[model samples]
Each structure stands twice: as C-alpha cells, then as structure tokens.
Target: MEVDGSKGNMAESPTNSQQTVSDDDEIDYSVKPEFYDPKLDDKDELWVQKRRKGYTSDAVLSCPACFTTLCLECQRHEKYVTQYRAIFVINCKIDSDQVLKQNGPKLIKGKSRREASSVGGETLKKVSCSACSTEVGVVDEDEVYHFFNALPSES
Candidate 1:
C-alpha cells in the first residue's frame, strides 16, 4: 500500500519553509451580533427580577463570537461541595448535530470546576465560536446542558 504525504501521516512534518500560520496570525473572525433581540417574551416576574439582579434566562447566553444561542439559564444553585460557590445550571434544546455544525472544531475537552467532581471529575467538552474561536460555554457528554462564561447578548 502507498501512503500519501498530503494525508498527514506520522512521517509527514512541515518544514520551516512550509510557512505555517499560527492561530494568532490569522485574521480576527469572531462573530459579533449586529443587534440584541430577546426571542422569548419575558413574562415571568421572577425572571424579570433575576434579570435585573444580573441573573438571566437561557436566551441571554448568546455567544459573542457567532451570536449563536448557546444555552438557556434555568436556575441557580449553590455548590454544596464548595463553600460560597454558586452555579447556574443551563439547558440547551438544540440538537447536538446542529451544535457541531455551528461550533465546528472549536469544541474541546477540558476540566471545569463548576461541574461536580463526582461526575467524571469535572472533565467536559467545551464549545467555542466557530468564527472567532472564543470559548462560549461547555456541554456535557449527553449534550443536555451547558455552562457559559458570560450572560446572553453580553458579548
């Protein structure tokens, strides 16, 4: 059998003359929202109060990089294992296939302190903006929930 060099075999390595481009050298491709739009109606008075107090619903966790609606904020709970640590659990209804199509190869695996140590020791998959490659949130192995770094539309 013949091996193709272009297929990136183990023996294939780019030389300095190949002109490799680092991620930093690439142009900024982060997606920015032209306008903020809350797709869902804010009818719940408790939600309004929470939003005013800086807690937002799932609609607010839109990605700043691609303006993708990442996850919906469900509720805030105290981390029982960690003192003074509060976690906002988020729910995502989008299909995993759709998420992969939008986020692309930016989804990576890493450890998060927010997740319970009992559940795989905080190791989870994180999704980033496909365009700008900015980390937006994390998804569990089941893709039921995501934890984001910023509020929706804040980016």
Candidate 2:
C-alpha cells in the first residue's frame, strides 16, 4: 500500500499487486515432487540397502511430438534410444497402456517393413501417433512396440 500521489489516500500499487511471468520462468510439471527419490543417485552401499526394501523403478514414456505420456511401466528393459528416437520394450507381453489404448496402433494394411536392427522380428508394423497421425513407431509379432527409428539419414 502507498499514499496516493495527488489525493493522499492509501492505495495498492499495480507493481506490488500483480506479477508478470517471463519466458525464462518456465516450470516442468512432468516430475512429481512426492515421487522423486533423491537417494536413487547415491552410489553407496546404503543406497543399495534402501532400494532392497521397497524400491520400484518406473519409466515414463511420452510421445515425441506432443509430449503426452504414452506409457508408464516398470519394465526395466524398456528404454528410449536417443540416437534412433525410438522406444524399445524387451518383449511387449503386457497389456497396452492407457494412452496407447486411446490412440491404438493403426495397422498398415498389406504392408510391413524389414527392420535391419531389430533382434526379434524381421518385419514390424508401422504405427502413428493418435494425437498426430504421424509415423512414430514399429511393432513386432510379440506385441512389442519399438518407438521411432534410430536410422541415421544418408544425407
């Protein structure tokens, strides 16, 4: 509160009452504070003991284009390959995730691509993002979805 310049009356100033957020002031809402365990990074024997009790490792998979969480699973083998820009789950025997259910994989009728890097399948089904209909992954015969291609461009 401040005295009015002309009327001498107590009034609140705009600068004191309102706050403007700048472009630099961005907050990442993806990580939940409660679920964050700072001790996970500790490379000591105590950390191993703590994890042995009731520790669970979870990996959150999100769409590359829209950043919408596609899968939330504890499958320790699953990972997103940065070089290939794809997600690979060891063997997708588990049921589909909520995001994948909503935007299920659309099969490419009468077509399949020969994958050179996959250790499991010779050909995989190409899938698109529901939020984007853009090709983002390939699925194998075992129901494993390998997200994005890690193939480097020739040019």
Candidate 3:
C-alpha cells in the first residue's frame, strides 16, 4: 500500500536514464524483402500516339457494303466520315540489347504451350476483309502501316 521509493524498487534506479542506452542497441526491427535481389531503378519508357482531333468523331453512317446502318461508323453516330487512307504507324524499337527487339514472332512466343499446334511464330499477316477476302494490308516492325479507308474522306 505504501510507495516503494527505494533504489531497486519502482523509483529505485537513479541511473534509469542509462537503461535507454541499452534499448537503443536493440535489433533494428524493420520489414524488408526476404529475397533482397537488388533491381535497377530504371523504368521502361513508353510513348502513346495521340489520336488527332479531326480523325476521331462521334457521328454514324450506313455501311456501303452491307447497307446496314448498324456498321461501325453508324454505330458511332458519325454519318459524314473523313475518308482518308490511314497509315497505321507502329514503332517497334529493336535495340540489339533487347532479346525480343523488333521481333514480333519472338515477342508473341507463338501462343501458349497448350495452343502450340494452333498457332505459329508470331508474324505480321495481311488483314483482309473476312467476307470478301480482299487484301487490306500488312503490319511490321518499321512502324509503317498502310490501309484503305472503308469510310469516305473529308471533302
């Protein structure tokens, strides 16, 4: 019931200030990656081609082939399309240091192992009208793409 102000008791150690020194030496407790593999702080740079203002529209029109108003243009509500041959530019930077540099086949890896037989080495194939089999165009690593516009040009 009485307060023990003695040296070894609660108020006992007059050298209590020295106890803090021992506590400072306690193991530095901190969370760290278990498998501390040091990684380069560099980040892969990426650039996105911005769509031109005039190229994109919110109008729709009927399709010439199907005469269906439900085509891609008509669905978008864009009636008067700015007909232009689109050169789809794809920049494939193939640095010698990069394992899959400018190599489309190497990058795609020919589909999953389960789909090995179903797919071939990734190659740029000419896109043609599935219905008409018309040669649309091809894509490659040079960042150059040429295709005919199904839509009309801006008059």
Highest TM-score scorer: 2
Model 2 per-residue lDDT tens digits across residues 1-155: 79988999999777933677765576666757777777766654455345334533234455565655443332333354342322333222222221221123343233212222232324445555565555555555466665552222211
Q: Show pairs that collide, candidate 1.
A: 31-65, 58-72, 58-73, 60-152, 61-152
Query: What is the C-alpha local distance difference test score of each model?
Result: 0.44, 0.44, 0.33
Candidates sorted by TM-score, best first: 2, 1, 3
Worst 10 residues of 2 by lDDT: 94-103
Cα TM-score per model: 0.30, 0.33, 0.21
List RMSD in Å for every model shown. 18.5, 12.7, 20.1
RMSD of 2: 12.7
Collision count for each candidate, in order? 5, 2, 12
Error of 1 at 48 (Å): 15
Candidate 2 TM-score over all chains jointly:
0.33
- Where does candidate 2 clash, by residue pair? 84-150, 86-147
Q: Which of the two candidates, 2 or 3, achieves a greater TM-score against the reference? A: 2
